[model samples]
Target: MRLTYSARKRLGATSAGVVLTVIALVMLAPMAWMAFVSTKPDADIFSRTPLSAPEELTGGHYANLFDQFHFGTSITNSLVIAGATVVISLLLGGPAAYGFARYPWRGSGVALAFLIVARMVTPAALVVPMYTIMQNLGLLNSVTGVIVGVSVLNLPFVIWILKPFFEQVPKEVEEAAELDGLTPGWVFFRIVLPLALPGIMTAVLYSFLAGWTDLIFPMTFITDANVMPLTSSLLQMQTGYRIYWGELMAGGIVLTLPPVVLCFALQKYLLRGLRTGY
Candidate 1:
């Protein structure tokens, strides 16, 4: 029997819902376990079933993070690195994306292709050269060095993301603004940028995350606990003789929250940006 249009639509919706529900569960299961373990007393973590409810819960692991691991300092360092990376990525990538979309100069395509290729190079591959560069610049063992490393890796992605959005901005609108005596800079900042804000937010989120979650650069360039970001700082939980499992889980939870909060806050812009440029 031929299904009615409404029936088919309902069936499709149901299928999609089921698929999304399963996918969400799949993604959330490990995080849910992590949260549970973070709160579970160490005695209960291994003695019971992995997902079983614990008889006791405690926040001691969280306290231990600050007391033993200096997690507060790590959080601050991560924030600084992530924040600076976002600013630098937007400042440089925004203009470059605009120029790429609006201005057709000689070898521009080649330049952009080269940038895309650079972005494709694995981080592992760049580590040796990046370390040498940072060492020569006297940026080693510092937050600034990690920020520079992250920004270099993230800039090309930012440019790639924003270029299509910039291209979608109506040239007619900019010309109209120019006719009203707005300077080119004003037209871009006042007109083009406002229109392309979704893309900007998308770039901001990714660039921030790139720095926040980066481990290799921080591990390679930074030796001071004071300068280490939360991602690498989590490693302090592991010693040769034993791993602080409870505190490790607590630290994981801490490292996970900022990105989750940021994603929730920027969900609207992220969705719009993903839809707009493509």
Candidate 2:
């Protein structure tokens, strides 16, 4: 059958839309199941048709999470740690990135390479040394320790991401600002930063997520229930004999919500940052 050009284009677009819709549903299926299991009673969760609509909805799992598991404390801890990680990563990494972008010095390439290598080093390998250092410094079981560890882990990536954005800023602008008697720091704070705001926000979002979702650092460094973050608290739900699937599912939803919400909220800035930085 011969079709008009516009008709063929419309058919192609419709096919593409259908494929994308199916892919989206596939990706979201697990998250939907998690939410479903969270709201279902234990019997429904264990039913032969697990994905079927619940016969009775309940908030018992969520209630148990707060009342029995003390997930409220963990959520608070994750918030504090992630917030601190973002601030510290920006404070330290932002300038480091700017320096790498603007000022080339002796061994600058080597230094940048080393930073990339540091980022590649597995977190698992560093866990023992980090635990030892934190223990020696009396920072174990402290939010400060977790914040510092997470910030260090995220710093290299933050610097790497921001450097490209900084490089995109025209040097002539900085030179013009300098000729007007503005110092380098002033130029960076007033001029360069505004231009690079999108990239900086991207770094902040990623660094925050790193700290928020980390299980290894919190599990290794913290023994106190008072300081456990959401990731570590979720682990406590599992034991040798059995697992609390319902409460765990509810906790997983709670743990997942903030980052999901943040990504949606900052989708514009994040997309812009990626486009600009690359």
Candidate 3:
């Protein structure tokens, strides 16, 4: 019995939906388990029926995180460092991207290629050199060092992403702005930036994520508990003998919430920027 075209189309769409739903659930399973474990008592966390609903939800892990681990201070440090990194990346990368897209100076192509290569370099390979340099400069074990490190790592990516967006802007609009006696900087601020807002937001979001979730730089550069970010602070949950699963899970949830919330809030612009390449 052959189906009609409409019926076959509907069937195909339904199959696609099911497949996508399954994939989404697979990806989200670890996060869901982390959240569930965070709410369970230490005794109940290892039950045979691990996925079963807890008889009672407890905030003990969260309490221990704040009281014992000094997580509040870590949260503040992470926020400050990530915010600083985003500002630095945008300030430096935006103008560089505009120059790459709009200007045709000699060696411009080579410079852009160098930026791409810099982005490709592994963080681990640079960690030792960076540590040495920061130590020589007396910047190690401080929030400023972490901020500078993360910002440099994110800047190349920001430029690469934003350059395409700037290229999408029509040259005629900028020429008209110039005819109206607008300086290049003013034209960029007033016209080109507004036109590329979505891409800017996208770049900002990625830069924030890079800075927020970076563990290597923070772990290597920051030894002072007073200024550790959440990523490195999570390491404190482990000891020579055992790991604090409950507190670790709770901390993981706390760390995950910000980026998730931000992404959802900016879902519209992020999706648009990705689809349109701007």
Please report how far candidate 1 places residue 129 from its true position, in Å. Answer: 1.5
Give the 10-residue window scoring lowest on summed lDDT in candidate 2. Answer: 269-278
- Per-residue alpha-carbon lDDT of model 3 for 1-278, expressed as tens digits? 99999999999999999999999999999899889999899889978988788899999999999999999999999999889989999999999999999986999999998988888789898888989999999999898888888888788888988998899999999999999999999999999999998889998888888889999999999988888999999999998998999999999999999998988998986676466532
Query: How far is 27's C-alpha from truth in model 1 (Å)?
Result: 1.2
Per-residue lDDT of candidate 2, residues 75-147 (tens digit): 9999999999999999999999999999989999999999988888888898889998988999998998888
Off by over 4 Å in 2: 272-278
Instruction: List pairs with backbone clashes in candidate 3.
Output: none
Off by over 4 Å in 1: 1-16, 272-278
lDDT of 2 at 256: 95
lDDT of each: 0.89, 0.90, 0.91
Could you tell me every candidate's TM-score relative to the true structure?
0.92, 0.94, 0.95
Cα deviation of 196, candidate 1, in Å: 1.5
lDDT string, candidate 1, 1-278, tens digits: 89999999999999999999999999998778778899999888877476678888999999999998989999999999999999999999999999999887999999999988878888888888989998999988899988887899899988988999899898999889999999878888999999998788889988888989999999889888888899888887898999999999999999998898888999886676566433
Instruction: Quote the positional error of residue 143 for candidate 2 in Å.
Output: 1.9
Q: Which ten-residue region of model 1 has the weakest summed lDDT?
A: 269-278
> By the lDDT metric, which is better: model 1 or model 3?
3
